[model samples]
Target: MKVQQLQNAVEAFDFDINSDEHIPELGRLIADKQVVFVKQKLTEERHYDILDSWGSPGMSPVIAGIGLGKLKGLHWNAVRNTTARIGKLIDPRHRSRMQSVTFQKDHKGRALGIFTNGKLGWHSDQPSFESAQRVVGLASVEASEGSQTTFLSTAECYDNLNCEDRSQVDELMCVNRWDMISKNVFDHFAGELIEEQHAIMRYNGCPLDGLTAPLKGQTASGVPGIHFPGSLFGYFLGMSVDESKKYIKHIWSLMDKPEYIYTHNWKDGEVCYMDQAITLHARPTSVDEGDMRRMWRCSGYLDKLYPGQGPMTMKINVEGEEITWDELFKRVDEVRKAEYNRTKWSKIFHKMP
Candidate 1:
């Protein structure tokens, strides 16, 4: 398999999983390019094999209970399942993770699932999770015309800033929060089931006051890059929400330049991997309703780098009291059970017709 550089941001090659050097070389290329693409589609076994080669696959905090049994992995099945069924199938314990990405619409033109038909704002996958996957892989099962995935190099974004701007943000920390109860569509259909069912859990709750690292940090290979979390960012420590917005906008202005971005129009049978820590990716609004687009995503932890570490501590507020994360989740679960018992028959009755 010949390896070639694509747009300076991604390295592309046809994968050969059996070659002794391929796996190591793949690792090296990912470190250098921040993203890599394989032109060939992989079988299910090969797909999992490639991911295992990196590290233990990270459990998705969004799609909860559907597991690969002893295989210990998860799959996002947007193309094959209906929106309501997908919503009903998700394990409430993992409801906070972003739901499926799709532009599918019903005959009436209403959005059919968790994601809207509009463009997804820029983000790295689940940056707020304490066990956030260090590497993410997506394999295309189908492709849509006029739909493209864009990527920005945070390290490149950081380097382009003036020295003073760099110094100002280098020591700062961003307080990231995603109120699963507020931002997600699960509750819209299921009615706070996740929150009520104690599914309002995250690996780590919000960052503690005054605890933060640079918005720019060193990559696994010791390369400095921006770690902007985009929409997941709530506010920067030591700055008011307004101040944080202005600061973030200023940083985005520098990073948004054309030369810093790479856009890929995916084709069927292609797979892409990205170093989630140092990059931000987005999808433009896909307007073609007749087109079918599908991709399978999997995540893996950074456990190899930090051995024997357990789940990070989390915190949350319950009725204005700051409580332990576990305590809060217990309350949510209790609420869910109560709500489920109250509505179970009604839900079944609604479907009976």
Candidate 2:
């Protein structure tokens, strides 16, 4: 979607996106610019308010075309390692590895589960980290001849239920260690996961069994959000051993309802980004990973976050010695300046003593 055409689409929708004003550009900016941006403009003056009502400056518009707009296709995969080369660099903070590299077949079938495939257990992303959200990007290289990227917004999910389900989740937490959840089968494991002894280290993802991220959430207009722990299955809030299992069955039964799902039919080059906070997504699989199904799926959080608290720093091991905070900060600044343009974090490697 060309930049000018994006504005035109909004105008065509009769939302009057001011052309000569100070509204921040609707989509991404840098090396990820897009040729077109698709958005549902608002007739109400509270568009930002609607977005704000969702909480934080994290709303993603479906965008097509190339350039920065293409970043939307990136979803939330802003990590720099395509080959999983940095698998060695992750530092496990617990007895279990905090993330999952994911087996191509045994688990989610390399990311394909065309409709007839049974329901995916509900869960959120990045619940293991100290952070509250993760950026998730999706680009439809192809779709099930008729399937879409189906999702259940946590807000919508929690909102649709009774005040009782909401109350049960008021003060619960789940654990995110891999060993505590699933078995480690991938031989090509990240050094950190191995060392940390994690069972399945995917963020906020719960084991198909039970066990989930500890109490994690956010506040929107004073309404609180409590996610069902992935590890513990549907038991996170108040469901019991049998009840939790039943709860899973119940939510799964509701999968076919249109009000609870937003299935995305991917455009060849278009990308979609979403705030993990408001959305829970799943793909009905297609072929298998090695077949035509192999779409490069890479996931990572920001190598450095500019959290408003300002200039946070950490010392990391590089080439056998710790890189000082001063050097790390300088490197982070350089990275932020060159954001979205640079590939490979080898520049940080060269700074090794």
Candidate 3:
């Protein structure tokens, strides 16, 4: 493979996500490259805003950190604490109750995968929560020694699509269901609330005027970040098996350009964050199938900013600050207080006539 280079060892949109000190804004580098490489260095906080929009159609959950970087050196409890921090940073509407899941080889009797032969097909994260999730986080707790992440940007695919294709699929929304029992999605971000009652399709935030929905993406910068996930929209449009397959293949090809893809080769002790609207992430499985790979996923969204940004907020780095596990645990406990019990309620009960 012809490894693309950048000025003075600082590369943007590189497939390899690793230890370095350069962060590149990819919107400017879309000339010949489709992806941006964000080399990681230990910092006090994370970068906010990507050319202004919180959602992304290119690569998601705006990636950062590697199992080998920031995550590698920390204790498992510390990692869990950091993961908890991610949950707190999400929007309140969706974060009302968040699920914490660990992706590990032990669960599968070996390794688990989001991409590869036995994995789910190309997909966006979290399609089933009543409270839409905007940002998603993944840390390589035990990433197979040579494993890395491959991100596909849907923005480029949306742009290259023909008018007819766009029209037919534009208004279509996806029913993103998470089959946790099947391993397609985890239970933490997949299940419905007590009030939702075994529901499958997530809510569509599209305006009453039939404007674009969250999954359809907005047309602000004049660049259509993405159409809809082909599987979901194809059914709505009544697309033929062959026809949909062709378009899906075409879009997949466009996203494969080295310039458009950010391959994250992890080093111990790092983390990555990306805009979910624009990003799609996956990774290869282990060759041995006997090695243990442990990872933790915590997410938030930009639409769901720290102070109730929406379901779209994924991670907040505490502005490069550090807090002990005990401190983090106390904060989490405070948020999900056990004081809501009936006995506690009667202490200050006020009944109406």
Give model 1 RMSD, 1 decimal: 8.2
**Candidate numbers sorted by lDDT from highest down:** 1, 3, 2
Tens digit per residue, CA lDDT, model 2, 241-303: 566556545544533356655555544433444434334555543332343321212222222
lDDT of 1 by residue, 1-353 (tens): 56775764765555565554577567556656787788777654455566666565554433232232211211112211332333332244322221233444556554443333445556675455433456667666665445778887777777767889988767666666544224543232223222211221232222222223347644445567777756546677668888988988888888887787888888777777787667778776453455567555555643444343212322332222456544533443454445456677778888996
TM-score of 3: 0.44
lDDT of each: 0.54, 0.33, 0.36
Estimate candidate 2's alpha-carbon lDDT, on a 0 to 1 scale: 0.33
Please tell me which predicted candidate would have the highest TM-score against the true structure. Answer: 1
Top lDDT prediction, candidate number: 1
Task: List runs of model 2 lying over 4 Å from the truth.
Answer: 1-123, 130-132, 141-147, 176-216, 219-226, 231-257, 293-353
Residue-level lDDT of model 3, residues 200-287, one tens digit each, is 1221211011111233552222334653442222222344546645765665576666665656676544444433454566554332
